[model samples]
Target: ISSHVHYSGTREDRSSRVVETIEFTTDRGQTVRANPVVSDTGTVDRSGMSVTVLHDRDRPERFIAPQNGHGISARVPVMRIGFGLLFLVVIGIIVNGGRMILGQLPFF
Candidate 1:
């Protein structure tokens, strides 16, 4: 299994941090993409870029791209969980959204 990283460009995330959009080819020959907001390495332009990444054994899409001996902040996963909870709550509300809004009985 071989792995590699490709740096496309940078974008300012909501946190005002400049993040690099990278795509990596997994050992399974599947390409996974990630945006790492913090990198210890100076920077890599389109000219060429490379970095090492460790992925989940069961889910390759979840990975970490460490730069210059530093890994990205761990709070990211916490945020993902929060968003997932919010999504579920929204779906629950929508299940009987009309009833809830109209103050109807037997809200599902």
Candidate 2:
């Protein structure tokens, strides 16, 4: 991303206009190159990984994958901690309000 500004004239009557450009360029050269050009670089192979599965008739049982449980039960203790802090804040507010109206501290 780039911006170019052109200023015409001196301080009293100066005027400027900005030209901005935002782009993506793959290759750079002295001259602008046009696309749709093909080269004779042999063959472009785009084949990726291949997976094969074989079944045997003599096997009595297939493989069983181990189960990975979710994080809900593990996160319950953290939620309980946050709830305990919130309850403490509410109780402190109630105690302070009662002490303010009663004209004395809640606990001496």
Candidate 3:
């Protein structure tokens, strides 16, 4: 496991510290590498940080953890057939009922 710490001071003399790099062993007995970064926010005592992960089989890029703790893999197309079938069923019902009821009403 390897790690690095850095300190950066802004022009206003306010200092900020950031820690990066993490190495650990996975359940499969494989080595994993990651870099965690911390940055200062506009508010005092508040900062944002993220980790960049490097995978053996995938591309290396920075990834921010989801706010809700749920990670998304990829995007999928929205299924339209279900909605289309629902719309057709409603239209068929409305048309059939309209004809039956209108036929009994006197048009004059």
Candidate 4:
């Protein structure tokens, strides 16, 4: 079923979190209400919009929202920068070690 979504708050890095509750019935006649948190993106605020949810038959409590993967995550860019810095550090160490070894050679 569809439920209204509201912006709960933002993450540590200032990324927004949009949360919505999904109500559904399980195969075993169990009623489950799942609240799925998604990233708030786009030019408009989706606070009043409804969200769709998909649940596992075996485990009704385990559910997911289609919008979860719809946008680029806030962590992607930061992770890329972190990896790039790590690569540079590794290359610097390798180059320095190679220079030290080659400098020990008697041949000019």
Candidate 5:
């Protein structure tokens, strides 16, 4: 697998993106090139990295690279906690606003 960094947009709005290309030989002795599956960290100058390719039995050209799967990482948990906190804050604001509106009502 070959990884390359691609830049898009003008100077003001430029963004960097990583693309991974995989070259493999099919059973029929045909060389095929396809994009490999990559994780978010795949773009960090990890060029010429070796990756395991899982190809389709019928269509050898169609393939995917599964990222290493284990338990939850620190990044995911932090994101979840942040989103949960944001949700709670929003819910709390809505409930507080409703309570304020009900307090203004003539009927307690």
Candidate 6:
């Protein structure tokens, strides 16, 4: 197996994405090469990285790479909490502004 960085986008905002592809022989003596989907934890140097794959018995081409068993990235959870707090703040401001507008009406 060989690994390389896959760069995407224009020169101003280029992003470095990493992907891993494996070459293996099936039980029936067929050679197969495919790219495997892995988690995104930022730029990864998969160069010379060795991994073990488990192939499907029914379909030899199908395979899976065992995960490291770690949970989601730290940035994901932090962003979720940040967005939630921001949403609450916006809602509170909208409600308060509406009440203030209503109090200034002639009906009051």
Q: Choose the strongest candidate by lDDT.
A: 5
lDDT of 4: 0.62
- Candidate rank order under TM-score: 5, 6, 4, 1, 2, 3
Ranking by lDDT: 5, 6, 4, 1, 3, 2
Worst 10 contiguous positions by lDDT, candidate 2: 63-72
Task: Give stretches of model 3 more than 4 Å off.
Answer: 1-78
Evaluation by lDDT, superior candidate among 1 and 6? 6
Give per-residue CA lDDT, model 4, range 1-108, as digits (tens): 334434444565454333556676766899987664443343233445555555667876876655553543567679899999999999999999999999999983
8-108 per-residue lDDT for model 2 (tens digits):
89999998654322222222312221211211111222123121212122331221111121111334568889999999999999999987878874655
lDDT for each residue of candidate 3 in 1-108, tens digit (9 for 90 to 100): 233445567777866444434454544566655542322211222123333333333323343222223443232223466677889999999999999999989992
lDDT of each: 0.61, 0.38, 0.46, 0.62, 0.71, 0.69
Alpha carbon deviation, residue 16, candidate 2 (Å): 78
| Model 5 lDDT per residue over 18-89, tens place | 777778786778787887543444455545766566677677667665554332236766899999999999
Cα TM-score per model: 0.38, 0.30, 0.28, 0.40, 0.53, 0.51
Across residues 1-108, which tens digit of lDDT does each residue of candidate 6 receive?
566787899999998866667787777787778865444435555556555656776776676544443443467679999999999999999999999999999997
lDDT of 6 at 60: 60
Worst 10 residues of 6 by lDDT: 64-73
| Candidate 1 residue pairs in backbone clash | none
Q: Which lDDT value does model 2 have at 96?
A: 90
Alpha-carbon deviation at 65 in model 6, angstroms: 2.5
Report RMSD for candidate 3: 13.6
